[model samples]
Structure formats: C-alpha cells, structure tokens
Target: MPLPPTVADLTSFDLLLSVARLGSVGRAAAAHGISQPAASSRLRQLERRLALTLLDRSPRGSTLTETGALIADWARAAVEAADALGAGISALRASRHSRLTVAASQTVAEYLLPAWLVALHAGNPGLSVTLRALNSADVADRVLSGEADVGFVEGPAVPSGLDSAVVGADRLTVIVAPGHPWSRRRRGITAAELAATPLVSREAGSGTRGALEAALGSAPAAVLELSSTTAIKHAVAAGNAPGVVSSLAIVAELAAGTLVAVPAADVPLQRRLHAVWPTGAQPAGPARDLLSIARRR
Candidate 1:
C-alpha cells in the first residue's frame, strides 16, 4: 500500500522538528543542507497534502503549531523505526559477508584449498572460514543441504540440482611400489588391463574413484578400498596393490620413489575440479571471494 502523502515525505517531517528546535525555517534548512526557500516550499507542500498547517511562518522565524508539535512527536517514532530497520539490515549483511563455510573433496582440501585460503585471508583480513574435507559425493550433499556455503569437487560430472563452475583440472595417476611390474614397463598399460586388474582404491564416493570409473566406463575391481589418499599411498608402497590417486596427492612420494606413477595408455585420466553451490544461489561475500581466488589460480 502507498504511504499517506503527509507522512510519506519524512524529510519534511524531520524539517518541521528541526524548525521547532532551531526556531526558524532558515536555521532548519541550514541544518538539513538546503536553502530556506526550498525548505519553506517543501513545508507548504506537506501542509497542503495533509490539509493541516504544521508551521507558523513569519519574518522573525518559523515555529511549530500545537498540531505540528503533536505530529512531530509521532513522526519521531516512524523515523526511529526506519533507522532501526536500516541498522538491522546492515548487521545481517555484515554477518553474511564476514563468515564462510566450505566443504570439499579430500583431494582438493588436502592439496589445493590451503593455498587458496591463505590468499583469501591475505585479501580479507578479518573473514572467518571453516572447512570440511569429505568425499566428492558428500561435498555435493553438504552444499545442497545448506550445511556449507560452497563446495569443491573433482568428479567428472556435477551432481544433479546444483550449479557448478570448473575451478581447476587434475589428473588421476596410477601408482605402485617401486618393485611392481608396471613400474618397470617400457610403455603405459592399456585401459582394459588397468580395469581388469584388482587395485587398491579410494572409497566409492571419492572423486578420484569416480573419474577412473567414468574413464573406463565401468568400476574397476578393488583389492582393497581406503578412504584417505595418504593411506592408499602407504598401502601401494608396501606392495599390497596398485592404487589410483590425484597427481597432487602423490607429488612427494613420486619424487622419493616411494610410489611410481604408471600411466594408462588409452584412458583419459584428467578431470576438472569444480566449485558447486545450490541452484539459483550464487556465492556472495567471502564465498565469492574464495571462488575468485580459485579461478585466478
């Protein structure tokens, strides 16, 4: 509904109170950063709109009439309510912009998120961020359920119902102990051999596992399944079975020869990493800033 004309122009009501306090339209106009004539004209319009004279104007000055004084008292409440409303909205915005919660796949959380978070904090000093490391499917669930402000996943396909943007790309490396036969092979193994062989692998919800299955068009047989990439690396190094892990996760081990990367000749091992959020809810505030940092890198 439209506001009543007399009460709609809160500035004029404010000017009336100022005139009552300062004892003149000229003084009120000066206080409100307007010319005396403009202030007088606004007051005239307001009086005509309400059909009530709110100011007694004379060469000496302007004074509030008895009815004008009563109206000013009521206007004070409306003005104060508006001020409170503004303050409340500001507080809500500050809360939203100052805090962020993130959920990410284990590969991203362990290898990529630390650097991105460091950059995010350097730019926004007082922002608070919380992170949860889960498998790719859990990351999507966290975002869709509103338990997290944003999520990062390395799966080949994004979960249904959430929007996503590719933030980075990663390759899944097939790794084995230094003594394994594949480590000594003159050429990379084919996808059929890699799929046919039982391997130590991450649990089903993992992005690494998902990418491998998607690339091979079926799930590979697992000799053992572990949740942590670190654990899988240790198992592979012990000559238990070859395992697939993010290239990022095995950098040091590959350098040390604790694990050797065995490539798949026919399989596409590369996957894109993504930032996911609920549909129609674009990231804002610190979440948006963190995503920007990810994309830049």
Candidate 2:
C-alpha cells in the first residue's frame, strides 16, 4: 500500500526535530547531511505545504511556537519509531555506548546545562554526553541507584545519602503578566500574601517547587500546576496568575515585555545549586571534569 502524504514527508519532520534540538537550522542541516541553504529552503517548503508557521526565529536561536512544539513532540515519537525500525540492534548499541550520564534539575537543564555541554564538547572532541532532566529528588535518586554518573540540583538542602558540592545559586523570581494587579504594586508582597494568592506553579517534586515550599513553609495556593516550563510560562503570560519560577527561566519573556516581576519581600527567594554523586564515591573522569566546570561557572 502507498503511504500517506505525511509518511512521505518524514524527513521534513526529522529536520524540524533536529533544528529544535540543536537550536539552529545550520547545525540541523549538517546533522541531516544537507547544506545550510538547502535545509532552509526545505523547511520553508514544509511550512508552505502544511500552512503553518512552526518556528519563531531569534538572533540567538529558533524556538518552536506553541503549535510547533506540540506538533514536534508528536513528530519526535514517530521519528524514534522509524529509527528503531531502521537501525534495530545498532541503534541500541549506539545508545549504550554513551560515555557520560548526567541528571539535572529543571532549572539547570533548561538554563545552564546546554552551554556547559557545548563547552565540554569543544574541549573534549570525542566525548559523548547523555543528559537527564528531572527534579532534585529524582536526580539524587538517579545518582544513588547508579543510573547517573553525576547530578546537578537546586534546592534548599542536598538529599540524604548523597555527597554534594555547591556549584552556584539560583534566584527565584515572582512574575505576572504586565497588566496584573501585582505588577503595579509599589511594595513587595508579604510571604503570607504571596502564599495565599493563587498561582501558576510547577508540579510537586520539582526543585523549583521545593524551594518555593521551603520559603513559604507550606504549599502555595495553586490555581494551575504544570510539569513543563513552557506550559507554565504560557499560562502565566496568558494572565492565569502570578508565578514563582527560577529567574533564568524567564529572561527572554522579561526582555520582550511578555512578563513582569513583582518584588518579593519576606520570602527566601534564593537556593543553592549543587553537584551531587553517590555517598562515599566521588565523581571521576568525565563526571569529575563536568563537576569542576560547573563549580567554576
């Protein structure tokens, strides 16, 4: 039987995913064995065929629009399935041949780790890195179970049974849509008031949530809870409610005037970021090198 039009266009979807992962079209072109101009033309043709604007390009990189991100997730699953069918055992071997596995909290993964990975790649040309992004609790769990070589966390305290080093500090920011009532307030919100207000928040078990909970001494009133940072950003920017999130998460939005920060007083708005490994076992090789870099940063 003949395949559907979408099936015939699988390469375009793969190109989309590659650009999304690598952060630029030029890099995606090289990954997919095409020239930069050719990849750009193909992407434009794909959008014309589908009648959709999928990417929002910026000076630094291209980001998927909301509709684009949704479609890309679906496309990624299909691509993985096709990859498994095409490569079979070799794909499994390639996955298992990874040299380093690092688990990190949402804050680090979204904000910091990409730059670090790029630096590591430049210095160690042949090194392969595997990154897992989860909450601090899960990062510690991965380290403890030997599922990860090292883990980066941002929380009030290091988890029990893990040895950790302070790498940096992450400041939490309280943000609302520009037209929200909080944006116009002259004084900082009291901890009680901040806790009482309904907010768009991270799901439970996230390091960002953990830090918020610790500062509030209890749970904040959540009007909506989402697991993805993009989803939360959208909810807040659409005027759902105020949100307390890692400062690094909203730089682009803030610069674009899509969100505004509210002064937060009487709230512990900072948390220490740490690199953790199993108890009695210090990181060696790639893990140790990464840890040193993180500390220096």
Best by lDDT: 1
Q: Which tens-of-lDDT digit does each residue in 42-89 have in candidate 1?
A: 999889888998878766777888999998898888877877988999
Tens-digit per-residue lDDT, 151-253, candidate 2? 9988888899999999889899999998898888889688999989988998877888889999999988889998867788889999759998888999999
Q: Superposing all C-alpha atoms, what RMSD in Å does each candidate have to the true structure?
A: 2.8, 23.6
lDDT of 1 at 183: 93
Predict model 2's lDDT versus the native.
0.86
For model 1, the local distance difference test gives 0.91
Off by over 4 Å in 1: 1-16, 21-51
Clashing pairs in 2: none
Query: Model 1 reaches what TM-score against the true structure?
Result: 0.86
- State in Å the error of residue 157, model 2: 1.4
